[model samples]
Target: MTTILVTGAAGFIGYHLSRRLLEDGHEVVGVDNLNTYYDPALKLQRLQRLTAYEGFDFHRFALEDGDRLQALMRERDIRVVVNLAAQAGVRYSLDNPRAYIDANVVGFLNVLEACRHHGVEHLIYASSSSVYGANTQMPFSTGHNVDHPVSLYAATKKSNELMAHTYSHLYGLPVTGLRFFTVYGPWGRPDMAYYLFTQAIAQRRPIKVFNHGQMKRDFTYIDDIVEGIARLLEHRPAPNTSPLTGSAAPYKVYNIGNNKPVELGRFIEVIEQRLDIPAIRDYQPMQPGDVPETYADVDELIRDVGFRPSTSIEEGLGRFIDWYTGYHQPISVAP
Candidate 1:
């Protein structure tokens, strides 16, 4: 079994991914600072589940601590490194831009450094669909130009791709970057739009419909995302020579998404149907640093991994609501 290190191990996606890896008999070393960016209680709960696995190990630290991170890599002899930790949220970046830089940029550099020195076989990190900011493409493709990022969060993700490429070129690091679409499911982040909408609707409160209900999202289920990641864990990228730089960097990027865009209004209606309650629609204009639509082109992901996210919103939301109701019985309004 491969010894893999997953950063942000207590996060929504990271927790799920780590559990999957452990189940697959891989020795997983999990790292997270348990930061207060969201509820630490939820993070702890996820960690508790992972701790039950015999193959799982946990470390309480942030990626910004380069010395400690390097030490951990050396100690564990980590082969595959999955960097999923980041300062998430596009709107939050407007007010706290520095947090994005510190975590996404500086922290990522430490991850790259650790992988470069630790004989890590493959370096897989999370990128976001937000990097396609201001691009009105129907289905966002990795080959499409992503140089015009509207928000600081997106800019940081783009910077990660560039930084990863630099390391791959110089050190022959096998780097794979995943640009995730709107991922939603049980044990998901409370700050995401889906979770917020579900909470509001359950409490008989108004749910804010952004872009006047004109926005569309490629809402990928969490299971599909984790499945794609599991497949790619062993499918490391090969060196592809670039004529511009004359460097054959073992680097690749793929979009892991549903490849189907659902309207914001309809998405809420599904939630309402599941909750058996009608939502008070508070239609709002598009927020700053927000786009009207996000659709993913998962052609490369399918071609390489022979997998595609096919979970429909109806079925995926049904499972999520089932878990949500059970987990949050007697749900209270969020502060």
Candidate 2:
């Protein structure tokens, strides 16, 4: 069994990945600062489920602590390092720029450094679809140059891809960065549009329809994301000698998303139908740092890993709502 270190193990995607790794009999070391970016209780609740597994270990810390991170890497036989931890949310990044700088920038640097020094076989980290900033490109591809980022969150993620390439070039670390679309499903981030919309619709409150509900997102499901990740974990990129290697770096990026782009209005309609409640509607112009649409071109991901995300919105949302109803408990802190 490989020993895998998953930063942000308490977060939505991290928890799911860690659980999958454990189920596959891998030893997983998970770390999270348990920051109050969202509700720490929710993060803790996710943590509870993973901690019950025998193959999992937990640490509470931030990515900026490079020294501690290196120490942990030394302490564990980490064959694979999946950096899923980050300060998430585009709108929140506009409000709290410091968090983005601290976590996404400095925090990610530490992760790169730890993996570089720790004999890590593969380092797979999260990127975002937001990096396709202002590019009117339909079906965004990772092979495209992502220099223009609209949000600080997107900028940091773009920076991450560049940083990983440098590390891969100098240290020969097999690095893969995944540009995720609007990933949603069971145990999703509360700040996400799907989760928030679900909560509002459940409470019979008005769900803000952004950009007059003209927004479209390639909403990938959690299971599909985990599957893509799991597949990549096994398929580490090989160092290339050809010019395509772009300075001999063992680094690659791919867009992991459902090819289907669902409009925000139609997405909400599905939620409303599921809950059997009409949403009080609040139509608003698109907020700052919000993109009008997102579509993923997963040709590289499919070609490289032999798998791609295909979960339908209906099946995915149904699972999310079911989890939401069962997990809700007055937002009490997990003891």
Model 2: how far residue 13 lies from native, Å:
0.2
In model 2, residue pairs whose N, Cα or C atoms come closer than 3 Å (at least 3 residues apart or on different chains), thus clashing, are: none
For model 1, the stretches where C-alpha displacement exceeds 4 angstroms are 242-247, 333-335
Query: Where in model 2 is the C-alpha error above 4 Å?
Result: 241-245, 329-335
lDDT of 1 by residue, 242-313 (tens): 585576899999999999999988899899899888899999999999998899999899899899999999
Best by TM-score: 1
Rate residue 280 of model 2 by lDDT: 83
What is the TM-score of each predicted model, taking all chains together?
Answer: 0.97, 0.96
Write model 2 residue lDDT over 1-335, tens digit each, in one string: 98899999999999999999999999999999999988899889899999899989999989899999999999886879999999999999877999998999899999988887888899999999999997777888766678889899999999898889889999999999899999898888999889888898887677888888888999999999999999999888887666754477777788999999998888998888887778888999988888888999999888988887889998899889888877763552122
Q: Cα RMSD for candidate 1?
A: 1.7
What's the true lDDT of residue 173 in model 1? 96
